[model samples]
Target chain A: MRKTLLAAALVATSFGAQASAPGGSGCGWGNMLFEGSNGMPMHLLATLVNGTSGNRTFGITSGTNGCDTSGALSYNGENMLAQAGVMEEVAQDMAMGDGEALTALSVSMGIPAEERAHFKKTMHENFNTIFPSEDVTAEEVMGNIQTVMNKDKQLASLS
Target chain B: MKSINLALILVLASAPLWARATNEELAEHPRWKALLHINEGTTWRYQGRSYIDDPEFFLHESGATDARAELEASIEQLRPAESEARCDFPARYRFLSQQLDWPDDGALSHCSDYQEWREAMPEERVALIFPASYLNSPSSMFGHTLLRIDRGNDEDGVWLSRAINFGATVQGQENSILYIYRGLFGGYPGYFSNVPYMNKIRDYAHLENRDMWEYQLNLTQGEREWLLAHLWELEDIEFDYLFLDENCSFRLLELIHLARPDSTLMDDFRFAEVPANTVRSLDRAGFIESVDYRPSKANELDALVDRLSASEQDLALALARDASVAEEEAFQALAPRSRNLVARAAYAHLRLQNREGERSQEVAQRGLALLRVVNRTPTVPDIDPQRPVSPEKGHGTKMLAAGGGMLGDRGFGELQARFSYHDWLDNPEGYLNGAAIEAFNARIRRTEGDDLTLEQLDVVNIKSLAPRNRFRKPVSWFVNGGLDRRFIGSKRHLTRHVQGGPGLAWEMGPVIPYAYAMARAENNSAHDVLVSTAAGARAGVLWYAESFQLGLEAEGLYYHNDDRRYRPSATLNVPVGRNHALRARIERDGGPDRAETEFHLSWRYYFD
Candidate 1:
């Protein structure tokens, strides 16, 4: 019972914080760009659409440090998928870096112009928040979004 | 070489008087005096050219003869002038009689002839070669004769010679003695380590040069024998050679035969260093330093020689030193040491910047060569114990450890535990066991420490599982003991158990195989111990370069002695990191009469 209360308290605090944040007030373009679609960094959505985990995460059973960490997160299907996305992005960056080519994610959702403009500014802030180095610029993020589109077409052709 | 000889003449001129001393006169010289005083009345003999003795004549009242004093006077009767020149005439040998035997001087018949000794002995008796006159002649004096006049072959032989000083007299002595005093024994006198073969005059003689004098005395059977035996006793023998070389320096001209036995160095006077710069210079001038530390004009000559021998180590060493030969390209052609050196260098290069060189292939080849040499060095194995063990020529994995144990109260009751195996030894075997015992002490608080209750204890319980092979059945068992408790308190005493049961097992998969099983709890009676039957499956998967696994088992327990039991209990376990795991288990309690559900969450630790 005490553990349940602690978990409830954690969720309440996280939800309350999420609600007060700018775009986090609703599940619109604001939230989409401020925090990721699923309480993760915004860059991950575009990353996951093009990655593969296959048979790796099937037997995962525990998490060691926390949800964002992989140890026990292996069994956390959503987290595993999220990690697969990050791994693919890292692998692609490394592979391309070998050729001296740099790329980053780009995002686009059909929303109000004012909302979209706000979302863009919010995403810029979020990007800085996630990577203190601010290495992924707005232009790179746009490029990544375009890549996702290209990848979606490829996946569509395969289907 | 000519300049070297001139320089040597100057050194000899500097120390003009350290030559030879007769036993009696030498008794007064600082260094020689020490040797003569070792034992009293012990005569030292020198059989070669000259000899000297100390004499002191006393003039007393006429006709007054004290027998002892008279003998003393007679013994010291040689006149002062005569004793100064003849009494100290240098003998060719001066050692005591005990050191060494005089060998026949290289086929010379001096001792065998009984006839007049005719053969002209060489300057060096050991090498048996005569030295040129200029090399052995003393400065400012005539050459002299030295002879082994001893009638006996051993220590009993007597040697004799004459003094060759400026104004010495040799009136009636043999010409051989006269020849020695006037003709040869001149320069610096050399020392002989053995007893002299002959003595005719005084106890000391001067030589301007030792090398020159040694050259002359190194003649004659007896003289050479005595000198060679004593050459080791010469002070500062280790540094005597300057340009002592046979093929390279002229000083070695006389040492060709004087080298100490068992030495490979050229007479301790001449030799060359391996890999001398001379060869290095030649190799750069379009030549290869051959197997002998000498340069060869054609590389093909060495290549052909090496090709003929299945394993040519020498040619390999030569090629290794050839800077023009790229190690990467020539490694396969070199011998083991050269190859090891080059390979190690290359390995060091690759390790820079985290670079990975062709280590796998290079190491394999070098390892093979070392193995071959180890196996082939000797034809007989029984005597040579340093042989290498033959290499196995196949692939395989090794499993080295597998075991498990449990600790708990010994009473028959209820309990809990977990089982695990840290190392999966080989693919074939893995071990683990989990168990819990009951009838533990119940606690209450009171004045005297904490009150303890040793109630009527229940049975002790146990469960275990061990995987043996991929396709073979794994072992599993459960045990329980139920016996009355003997002691009771907050701190309970000894408890006992009596129980037994059947075990379950199953196996599957390839390469990385696994299995599971269940066992019965013997704490309860047969009816209450409704032997549990469970099936568990395990599978391994690689996740991002790391390996991970999961296991799930479900079973039901029914105690035969009692009917309160349940079915379809299950256990789920997942390992997330090294040595740690989380497990969730669900089981029925009591019996079928009134079974209750129980669920448990546990953390487990495994050690390597």
Candidate 2:
């Protein structure tokens, strides 16, 4: 009788803590509009709403973003969480998109350190361990260069 | 008086027979035999046609009829002129200068008895017939050389003589051709006269007359002249459809021996009965030209012609000409054709495809054709249509690893040069052999609760030995040699220096396969030289479709100073890309005082 009463009291406390968290709105994707320096408070609120989201995804604040359609995180941040098993399918989809985007980024910024590592790891996991790459072609490399140069120009225009 | 007359008659009767015997003896002399052989070998003969225009007329009487009367009448009625060209059996020729004349005139000249004119014709009249075509063509019979047949001897048969026939013609009248005029006074048979008549036509025009057989040997001037000098004495030489019909077996053999001594006469003649011993000698010598005065006459002329002409002679001639044109089309094709008979013979040996009877038959036919072309025209090179193909991609190397298993890290490197010329080239007249090399290393390391043991070993072999690399198994000083050096140092181990001895390798394929030996040396003590002999085999397959290479090789070595020790190993390798490779290798080794086994894997990146 005493154990049951204590469990009921613990659950009520957890519910009360969730209800008091920031953003009563649904996952608060609009909160991602806040600048990188803002440290989006929505992720903390969302982590409470979705109990399985881990610290790698929820505690990142504005440093990294997840690949969720909710637009609160970037592909890199999502892939990291996926690798950690916080989000498996979501991380894989983000990695595929990241591979396509990184091809362009590689030509512009010589490949982001995080993206290069993630892509290499993915290749190792899929193909024969003898090589990390098998389908590199001249056409694909040129396409990447064009996209990266275009992206750089757009960013420069804004600047 | 009666007795004296009878004795004189007896002496006269015996004189002619004695002379005949002496003549026969002279003809059989060894010097004559040599001369005859040379003469027979060089002369060119052809069975071309001679054009003879038959004019329907009788000669006029020289004295019975009034010459002035006939001269006036003949001059009024007849005009001299030439006719158009006519086709002969082999080529076109023309004749010129058929004319009429009268010596005396009388009122009854026109009424002169034709019988009297015929009776007087044996003395002074002759017919001059002119042909009408092929007047200025290069192939016309005006500029070539011709031989005249001499008249019959006291006997009915005619003995061939070194005689030049009538001269060739020059620029004649606007519409007239030249011809030899046979007059009644000349007393030459018209049939015999025609033969030399056409021959003289080409001779004076400075063109090469086809031999009596009407086939051009296609020889260079010097060779043609040499052959011509020999051809005259050769007897009973016959031809069908412009080729040396195999019927001239003995002569054909002689020709082959002269032109290509290294050729395998028997192998080429498998379709016929070429003597076993003769073929064996030819194979050993690597050329037919080296053999002289063999039993060539043992095979009759009839049998040879029967065999070579067994197939259509016309077809063979066409094929031979086609092959010649194909050969002349390229300079690269011309080199092998000019090589010595021995080299050609070795090439033929390599070409014999014993796998299928069909290929062997084809090779035999090509060999025969080559023999014939060389025999007739020794200076013209013969080309083999088959040439080995070169590989497009370079070599491959690889390394493999499986953690915590009986196998350790293994590394292997392979270089293969591959091609499909033998298989892909159409109707190839020959084949080419490929070459390759493989080097492998095996390493095994074991740690029992932190105490570590390590070993490294390697075996190297090559397909076509390169002059650059110095590390290999040199099994014999006279056969092979190599040198290698290595240094190793570890945090918990002492520095070690290792210098490997030379290694030996054997390659037995098309270019060079299973026919090599090598030995290497190492130092046992300060003053001792220890030697080791290793025997090994290596084979590889190149997947051009995937641009991948795989190889398997095994090698074993035994030390002379230490008989109890034997080292044996195997290696496998695969290529990853142009600059990278993966390898796997394993080895079982033993020594005089200890034994060890190891496996190794390696990933090699090459800068060049």
TM-score of chain A of 1: 0.19
Candidate 2 at residue B290, lDDT? Answer: 20
Tens-digit per-residue lDDT, B80-194, candidate 2:
2211111110000000011112222332223233223222211111111111001111111101112222221212111111212121111111110001111101111111111
On the 0 to 100 scale, the lDDT of residue A34 in model 2 is 8
* DockQ score for candidate 2: 0.00
Tens digit of lDDT per residue, candidate 1, span A63-157? Answer: 11122234321111122223312322222222212100111111113223334333333332232232222234333444443343344433223
Per-candidate TM-scores read: 0.17, 0.21
For model 1, residues B140-221, the per-residue Cα lDDT tens digits are 0111212221222221111111111111111222222222222123211121111121111111110111101111122345
Off by over 4 Å in 2: A1-159, B1-516, B524-554, B591-594
